[model samples]
Target: MWLSNSSCEEVVVSAWGSGSEIGVEGDILRKVEKRVKELGQWEKDVFGNVKSELSRLRKEIAKEERIAMGDKNTRYFHSCATKRFRKNSMEGIRDEGGVWRTSQEDIGEVMVNYYKSLYTSTDRRVSTGILDFVSTLIDEEMNESLCREFEASEVASALQQMAPLEEPSPDGMPPLFYQHFWSTVNNDVTSPILSWLNSEGLNGLIKKAELQGEIHGYSLCRRGPKLTHLLFADDSFIFCKATMEECDNVLEILKKYEEASGQKMNRSKTSLFFSKAIPEEVKHEIKAALGVPEILHYEKYLGLPSLLGRGKKESFDYIKEKVWRKLQGWEAKLLSQVGREVLIKAVIQAIPTYTMRCFKLLASLCNEIEALIKRFWWGQRGDRRKVHWVKWEEMTKSKTIGGMGFQDLAMFNDSLLAKQAWRLLNNKTSLFYKVFKARFFPNSSLLEAADSRMGSYAWKSILRGRDIIQRGAIWRVGSGEKINIWQQLWLPRKHPTIPLICPLESFENHTVDSLIDPSTRTWNEQLVDGLFVEEDAMLIKKIPFSRNVAEDTLYWPYSTSGNYTCKFGYRFFKEEEELQLNAQTPPICHKHVWKEVWQMQAPPKIKKIFFGEHARMYFQQNMH
Candidate 1:
């Protein structure tokens, strides 16, 4: 058989099974459903009933697939079967010694021990003068929060943030358990935690952020899992279709939730976000129904810019405002050069990290950002200016390379995007990765995934990182059964410019091992030559076939070291950025050197007149 019933992915999927073919094609399934349409279908045959059950399951899966794939009813049988192997639930992890701990306490201890090793005590003594200065830096609000009393509403909100089915702690209880026993055990639970946090346990909250309120899901009032609103601390997200029904559902849920809990949704502050674009006429209709105006996109979500334009000019403009806002603040004027460097690195750059993790930021956007930082670095406060001694590029280089170790933003952006790619590859158990697998890529490997205009911008950004990921990915070939000769990236130490040995047509949907002599565990020369071009045919002889193992895995190209880090991607991008940026433009760093001289402990008159190194000449060169 060209395709096997054992699994759907074993066959190459050309297209999805058409809608018309549903409940009819795929032979064995057709016979079962045909009998069910007739009378007394279950009583007809023992084998036929099983097929009928499968037919119903297939129909359900088909409908869900269509919904998830944006109403596109396309997926091969093997592809559907392959998706079944994904683990949607926690399966617990093995210890470093390689033994799976089934008990919850054992697992908890393993996790605790693992994390404990990552921490080190900062036990150095500091002078009273330095300690007093640092203590002065702590905002008054922070101290007030430490001693703040826990309210009933606050505790409830905290409970609401936790996942209902989360793993039980060492105490054998999840948030769900506390929520159920709240009335009877309210004081017992609340008093100790409140006392601890107020007294000496403030750092515990930061260390264990796992303390969430309640998991968002369908309310008991709703039968289906129709989550309309989600609350995390103060922020609220209201989801609905651009119709009266959406408004009706949301309002009804809010009314009920308000009566039960003291908290209520702020109608005035509430905003609606549509997953799809809506017509202006329909927008007015939704507004009339919901009493909230429809918006194109929020200015920011969770401190990150959400739904910004894909273009460099539009997308990067927000970052400029963010950088300027930080520099314009009162703190900026008070800080020294070293203090400004820390603020720029720790605060300004950190602002865009969450957004950058999922985006391949434009080169010019990075440049605009660095330009603002460059101005700040040189003591440019508003229109007031200072001299710059070095190029931004030189300062952005590693500390060992005559620079301040300020990160090159362009390379940092690539590293962030590559981290997303790395997550898709390594974290298959993650919900996002699983959903992605179920929808767009049911039948293909990451390297073989086809581009789609229908894909979301975030997905497209992740796709952009695929090239970097592919460059670093090498396959650990075992049985060689899952390995595809033409489609997958398997070879180590091979350039990407090198084409596949055999044409897609020549291979005709065969595994890599098909070209090998199974007995000898070597390439079959005749089979290889007939399919591959002459040069590629010779190269095939050099490729090794593993005889000792049959399990296949994707290995990192940095080595078979088998670990995850964005450092490899960062290094590659750094090298590429150095070549491109250095070749294209002059250094922008030296423009601010004269300003730094003025900052020195020198006479005001001398500082004003002394122009550092070719200042007038440099300005003249840049003017035209």
Candidate 2:
């Protein structure tokens, strides 16, 4: 039978018999038969004895299946259905251990395709400028070489005698000899050589290049026999990839560009990083270019240590420590000169919007300053008493608070660090964490345990302050009872029949169960009762005809008789005269026994709490 029912008994039997009829192999069919028999026995022996258990298990399985299907649908909707749903579900998936995977090869293919399309779409003529320039230079060089070859035999005798002329000056030389030599040599030289001599001219072409706007600045220079490659700021990667002769040829071209540009090369910024041993002639040329006593194996420039040895980590540490020490010294000097205020401001400027630690440090430093001020100037101050009582909020507030507004570094640092939470949530793939892995914590971890170096005293102090704040005092206003909609202010139609007040000592201890349970009482029941007494009983001096209670005895409805009424004073009375008489003499108004009236005028203590000197001052200050 092809059972359509989804029940376990029916599905299992159908799957087993269907397997038997499919002409499956003997072993497979036997295994299926054995499993079916076992399942049938289990149904008869285990399930039949526990009737409700089977039904409950079925219900549970169905519920779980429904949930699984719903979750699968949610994932599919996010990935293929809508962009908004995809964004919303991404966080949920990540939290649920789901990871999106893409192949590096696929990424590379996409990048290559995009570049190829871009190149193909471009105009050929516009893209041929570089090739054309290189070709023209090569043609000129070839022409010069051919000309030199043609004139070599004729010029041999003249060049032979000219070599021994010693100290031949351009101005002092005989006119005929000078003209013949200059014309032969200048005309025979390759264009690359001519360009190099004209532009670089041996002095350095960095200045020329800068003047021509070809380079922002000269980065490096390495000399070669008859030429030098002066690296401009525009060139990120420049290295000799050919033999010594080819290198020299390339250097000649580079020199020509440099000489024409008028920018001087910075030999200090340059170095030769060869995979194989360099030629002696090339080394000599490089020495001449750099003017150093000798070429060192390694050197550092712009705070980056050159990678020449295996001690890369050590080298980095050496440079980093030196820089950090120097910064610290500078900070100390700045602190001394400008005082803590300007020093803190400078630190803040350096860190700006990057970390909350900066602000916390500022706040901590302020606390330190306050402590110091109190120790040194408290007793000696004119307004000593007043200064001690000054609230931190008031002290940090603007002049309107009767004190100068100064930054509280502790609070500032906590708030700043708190921003990191937002940053991490937003930028999951920033390189800052990658570069300084130890400085930042991994996701889903607390900041306190992160392996951040306490590089600065201010930063350490800020962290300490943050720890204290995490453990500091917390006050809550509400009964442990969960309020319904009527009790909430936003739900205007929903007002609590009676307001429930509870003080939460520990935030973590508060829960929905504790809030919903009305019977749960707090240690400070009197305080809660004072704030939320039934409206009807608020003005009642006593319950009439009750011998067990005195005239001024107070009773909450639940604590009193079971038949007692619960109402507020305002809702209880319909007339002002009745309210006044009831307040003056309760128990005389029997007709309005269900109601109690409170005088519109509040009691002395209530007046003190609401309209006393402090309250009046607060009201007047905020009146505008």
Candidate 3:
């Protein structure tokens, strides 16, 4: 039933189609062959010409789009889509379709038409391969011709006229000039010299002979008795001081290298500066034979400006500032990678290690981070008000106290110098200490001497802090008294209290007889098993006494306690009952000192001590 209904309801529509047969008729179709010949001639003449026009049209369209959208906002989607559609359509045209039959004559005409259209098509691939090759060949030939023309022209003469006058030479002597000097030497001359030296065991000898300081980069070679310095990359300076005849032998080696590498030394810049310190007979012989100058200096000289000059100071400052800026930039980049919380914490932690440079770098990092965060997260807020504060404490706190532990670079610098005292004392033979001593205090002990010339307010301040520790606590161990080993090693000679120690160097060295007798072992073991009295009590009791101890007796809190037995050892005090009974004394402070002493004996488990309400509040505000 459905099939019958569909068949009876057919509708028909007709319209004129643009087919060759319909449009031309049979008579016109015969004329089409003659027209095709004319069209082929027109296409061949116009194909390459129209390509430029097509490109111009595309550029104009693109310019209009750019003006409308702004260059940054312009989208590639439309251009890409148009290109893809054109490619698909052209591909379809290439394959046989309903309008075109693939006969031999028909295929030939179709291909010819396709080729003609391709030269001017919007698709660039059509022209790229062949055009690129032809363009490259043309450019090469043009370049060659241009180079020849330039060589024959007056350009070199004109350039010389424009150049500044040559720098004045002493005695009106014309300075020697070398052309393509560094390039020729670097490629042709230096490589073989390096290779020859690397083959011999005397490479170091070659490097020593060059001795051109830091400015004049040079290469060298040494083979057997021969040594050559490749000066300014092209010229060779050859000499051997091993024997009188070796000097001539060195020249022969230089000649061989020059021949092999196709480079000749400029004899004009090849004068030698001979040492005047050599024996008079040797110097006379060398000068007479070689005609070398006796300049009293054998080493290459650097042309650094005198430090007394303003220009030299400015130059030094500029270099230092540039280095600081570069370091700050690196720090800024690193801070950007870190989260705000971590960066803030690090800054706070670093404050304790204060130095002026570190402070400046941290401040710069903070400012940079603040600016970037404001730009990104609070754009409108930043625009309205230029200043932003993540927290007031970050800006207000002294670098030493806990707030935002950013280092006080000035203090940190002093601390670093102070630390050097330890190395000076402990490693007197170290090359660095030896050099420092030679430069600043040649006649003084590195351990005891502070350079009066170099000492500043900052250095003095660090020394003052160090002096405090040197004069401070004395430990009582059993019946003997001693001080920390570091105190003896590095404490300034002028320190108020000199450290004293028992004959035993360390606690481990003390025998059972030295502590309590072996007879008391059972009682000591029972005491140790019952309670954890730290071994620090025994160690502290052994420390030597100081006159300052008597003067500061009131300040010595633990000294009030009389002798009392604990798990680790016996603690002897002046009045033991006073310590047991004094509840008003700060338990937290006592616990801190107790733990410090305990760790000296053996590592102790730390117990957190709670502070009073007032103390806690004070610490919280100050810490932040």
Candidate 4:
């Protein structure tokens, strides 16, 4: 059913449009979709036999998409498309007397009245039975744990785990703000939350999950000194056991917090995720007590899925869709290859990396994403791939050796996850590391940790990139205390340095410090020279050390500054896999410079005028 090139153009080009004014952009997209749909099998079948015809259609789509991206209309369009707004006119509703109400005002009043009833108490009688049960729920043991005062370290631990991009509270402060100013405003921020947690409630406070927690099981993850509520500026989450007693206590605490903070609760967005194993009857009781829907898992935290099981495809399918939706904009087709490359690199691939870094993407998922990108890059529609002139692997190389410097998604994802591993390895004192330690690997270091049946997707993903991160980790010798001379990356070679993988007894306590001369805090040349051949000894000798203030540290060789970066990690993997360069360094040739001029965002007449003037000058100079 493939239509002729001419036919494809007629269908596509007619609906192409512009302008960010309300309704205009959507109209264009809607028209494009409708007209394209009308072509039906022909639409799928239609591709221009002539390269020019197809190219024009590709250009048209790109033109529309590029405009949308630049103008910030894409977000608006997406919101319009996804958000289901209530009809402005009234839908018929039955009044209390049984008469039908259809007026807009009547409908509005009815909706308001219905919502008001949810939070309102019709009968004001105090339930002695409920109160009596709540009082009995907490005994000497639970009260001792729950009543303890929260220390600054405990609050600091919570603040450290807050991701920067987490939604801003009603105070208009995002987690990023508190994170940056935590040092300066630590007391200001934590004081309110600490005060709230310490405040006595109507009944027993948090005893359990009741509230789940963060990575690096540190001061933050401790269920007790039992935390009842944690407030992020104006935003807060109440944590308590799934009992009527704890739920009632939380309600009183929240009421007090609202009075203090001046922020109302958004009940619509709030939900309860309980243990999946909880009985249905129990779940309903808890849900009723909290007045929030109960489910096994809820994913509204910081815009990331709070997954407890192994990372699955469905967990990341949203990520893929997010990536594709960004790519699917018609305005994208108008961009020059350079512009498209920038968009793909900066926008298309970027949307998912944050999530990808925190979790291992399925290989099939990775392939699907890569395929989607490849199609976009080549200006292909449906199955009609427009000559992918270069292999995709080559395209991922750095601009220095000369691929387009596109990040390979799989490698990039690994690199991002490796960063988390780096944090776990280097920053053990951080709450994240401590939490991860207690939950995932209490007995072993991050590298030594093994996967378990109950391990979370995040922990598993971090482990996946542990080896890659270790390979790039160059131990900067200081005290030489943390660096493992044999186990960790101590050598600066292209390959891993395994210094005689033998018995621990052979290496005198298996510490890097054992090899360091205590007096100079430098490598013990005698000990080093004796332990290895010429090549290994020389590498050990080149390992630098500072006696006074510099602590022994591990850093990446790929980065110039020794700091681990996502870009550097990506580049390292790309070079290792493909030694091929798709383009030459710098001016591979000025031959095609003029040919590229056509893609410039300028009028054709302007380009001609500039080139003509330059040519005349060149001719005059030559004649002279």
Candidate 5:
């Protein structure tokens, strides 16, 4: 049955029988309209039923669409897709003669010629001066092996390394097809890829330029690594001295790269970012020389600022605006309480997560975001004010602890930023860490790093995150040589970092390594028992030592993997806050029973309703 749900029609068409017969929909709808118009009660009932059915159908359709998109953030995905389309759609191209080619045929010709010039190489001989600088690291035997003809076994081995479902070539055959039908297509595949079929790619050209000293790169600090360029997939960021000579050299590198790689440079899309030290006249000359746009202040790279200036809150305000826009959508108003919760957690909270991972947002901004979410949660739309039944702080608690399990944005933000600090602590070998270490705190480790008074905003944000790490991180006992028993948090237990009883005057200066027996890589049980109180002794004795005598390592005890994660970090702070609050206030009666009520396996709305009813009944009976 072909049922059309077109809004323009008075009534939709539907088939009654299983075959091609049409239903008597016209007569039925006429009768329904007549009955609906005749009696006021009947009219009301019929209109209400129709409205309900229509709403249900719309909801079902929306649900199916969401499922088909394969993303819970369907609105977010749609927004991105729309933005990408607007940005990527090419209206026209300017030819070499400076005339716009708007027609498809003209544009096609321009593209073909542009790429043809890039791929087609001139028969110019290479200069011996440039080639002389190249070092031959390969031996004669290794060179011969590399230049040898390919074998079927070698071809099959290479094919096996590729993912089976990887995107196919122009032939529309994926890796899986070749692997599965190897017996049938082996001959056709192995013969074409000769060793002589070779060309220098963009990377090779860049490396040669670097080796010949034709290009220079800047360093984060005097002793840091000189970063010439950074390439993430298709996006590229090139660094060089702000001079006419360096700019010319960079342009020349790009010119050679285009010829070798069959890729045309999009000058209109390219931009040059200059430091404030560079003169305005020099900036103009450089922009004109490169034939690219000039970014006066900053531009976004992968949705984040490529360069951050003094106003951090202004730079990151887009995240807040994005959340507001998402909440303002009509779908948000239609969503149920459960739906709103999912949207807030999965989409709205995640909007800032990527930004938070790199920078610590202002406390004011976090509170504003929380206010927007809270307003939506309490059914306050536009100018209409609604009474908030529960406080946001109470709602931020876990569901099992008599709250809605909503994320506390400020805490979550700190946790996400702490992840960056965690990375810095664990991955000291990474280029990011090396650069930051050289610039901010070359003399100290991340744990001991003091705030740099004249550091970048990013450095300052990371230090804020380091505070959270400082609070929650405890050392895992290994060889324990570097850990001090008094200053550091080495104990495995939650509450206390040190022994319950104060350390003895002589023991305060000792390392954890002093407590371990040298002969058997185990804790000196007798010494531990004698030195501390019973409680401290039991906790210290329970901590197992590594058999191989590894170095003492810091770990977050809240997580199973001993690594600091955003979830565990936020929870740790929340628990600490709760502990402090509990200590200040009197204890509640039958707290465990109330906790059970919150933890019940029912819909949140139903549970809230049941609790309200139960509370009312209890108060009424007590009053009687």
Candidate 6:
């Protein structure tokens, strides 16, 4: 029952039937193949039943009974036992004296001594002056948040945040085990964690320091928000001027925090980055004062460059290498076309997605990535090229149309970058937005801000994304003061939201507010009708005003929610390209025909064949 006949038949039939158009099979041979699929399904069913019975037996055995059964009695237990010992074994340990100890006794003694030293505390004294420098950053609201009771959801989320296949816990269960069996273990796991959190309990101290003028933070521009510290989970980045006083203050704050919170800093892991302007002697002095080594550049933080320099391609070449490694392990020759399609979309395409969300990759690099995917799709390996039957551009079109629903990497990257830009457009309260706004456009809004030659690579990339938003986004009327009636696209209509009638010289600078009655906070019908043509006037009058007369804001009309999404943004560009292409070339298939092909009762694999063959025949007969 685990492997049903109908389900297995569908998968096998689809894989086998994909090439049925190229060669014809007789009714008897088709019947025999159908029987073979059924047999394969039945064989899988038999195996599933046996596996189920074995699992039941293993579960029913008590802890004592399992130990008595021994490794020799069950291959499953034997494998688990062997793997545990092999992976967990300690071969040797190097002592502090730089000698490698091979014996078990020496290794145990070394471990004990190391942990003893690690846990042991040294006498420390804090001057009253240092304590005075530390301000009261935690308020009543923050204190309450720290002291609040824990929820079951928080417990589950913490466990889920851990890597699924990471090393096993003390109980020999990896995170994957708990995640897989969460439903069964939920109450048991939740109760203990909640109890501990309720018993024990839990700011940006650097910001308060900056406010008190005890410390200073680096800024990109004079007007921008100063960059003091960045914190995400356990990672922290601290910025301050290169001075002994500043360094002492920072160290004191950290010491005070550690003493109060019982959480110790990993000094070995902490690193200091100094600007080139700082003198070499001063750098060394600060490093000694802070008790952390100085580094020219960080290796990586959260799997991304902490600071991107002039060499952008070199900085991001790792993405290309990662994609290549993924392709190397996959056997294109063994996988079905459908299987390949799934892997390419889900795995390969997803590899660059995280990086793309933060940076706009070079177009050449995007093309190179797409080339690797194209080769794999056509069964290419190790410099052996396969003839590409269709253009990559055609392949990226929607499945409901004539092509596979593959992403166009370049457009997809822009779409992702546009999403970041959209966030800045809307989330003005975010730290990122505030910092960028101060640095790049202190006086102007993101929409009206122009690209500058002096801008950083990230700033420039965001501006490129802004181009897409500008094309699709229109003003959602609120107060109507910000939207110009003749110039801006404010009317909620399918086409030509702006005025069709040319504006008279007298009314050239009129805003939407000119047509709004101030008393009623509604459209002045007489003014609207006089200014625009009937269609434009009708659309303008239909737009409802906010009850409270809210400020005018930008919105994308293509989406029902009116908010920008990467999916909708990417699709909008692709659809626009299709529209332009259709305008130039004669149509091969009607909209209703393609709709029917997609809506057919046939399986998707067969439906693809139907569309492919029809398109091929149509092109051969007409375009050729």
User: Which candidate should be chosen as best, given TM-score against the real structure?
Assistant: 5
TM-score, per-candidate, Cα-based: 0.50, 0.22, 0.26, 0.56, 0.67, 0.64
By TM-score, the better pick of 1 and 6 is 6
**By the TM-score metric, which is better: model 2 or model 4?**
4
Query: What's the best-to-worst order under TM-score?
Result: 5, 6, 4, 1, 3, 2
| Candidate 4 per-residue lDDT over residues 200-269, each given as its tens digit | 4322223222433211111333431333555464445555456666566567655664543323467776
Question: Order of all candidates by lDDT, from best down to worst?
Answer: 6, 5, 4, 1, 2, 3
Measured with C-alpha atoms, the lDDT of residue 527 in candidate 2 is 36
Model 2 segments beyond 4 Å from truth? Answer: 1-393, 398-404, 436-624
TM-score of model number 6: 0.64
Q: lDDT: which is higher, 1 or 2?
A: 1
- Kindly list the per-residue Cα lDDT of model 3 for residues 405-449, writing each as its tens digit: 232333333334434443444345555455555654566554344
Clashes of 5: 0
lDDT of each: 0.59, 0.36, 0.36, 0.63, 0.72, 0.74
Error of 2 at 619 (Å): 22
Using lDDT, give the best candidate's number.
6
Relative to the unseen true structure, what is the C-alpha lDDT of residue 191 in candidate 4, on a scale of 0 to 100? 51
> Which 10-residue span in candidate 1 carries the lowest summed lDDT?
8-17
* Candidate 5 Cα deviation (angstroms), residue 559: 1.7
For model 1, the superposed segments whose C-alpha errors exceed 4 Å read 1-241, 275-282, 296-298, 309-312, 330-337, 381-389, 434-443, 481-551, 559-561, 575-624
Error of 1 at 410 (Å): 1.9
> Residue-wise lDDT of candidate 1 within 277-328, one digit each (tens)?
6787787787777687555453656665566654546755777787778777
Model 2 RMSD, rounded to 1 decimal: 38.5
TM-score, cand. 3: 0.26
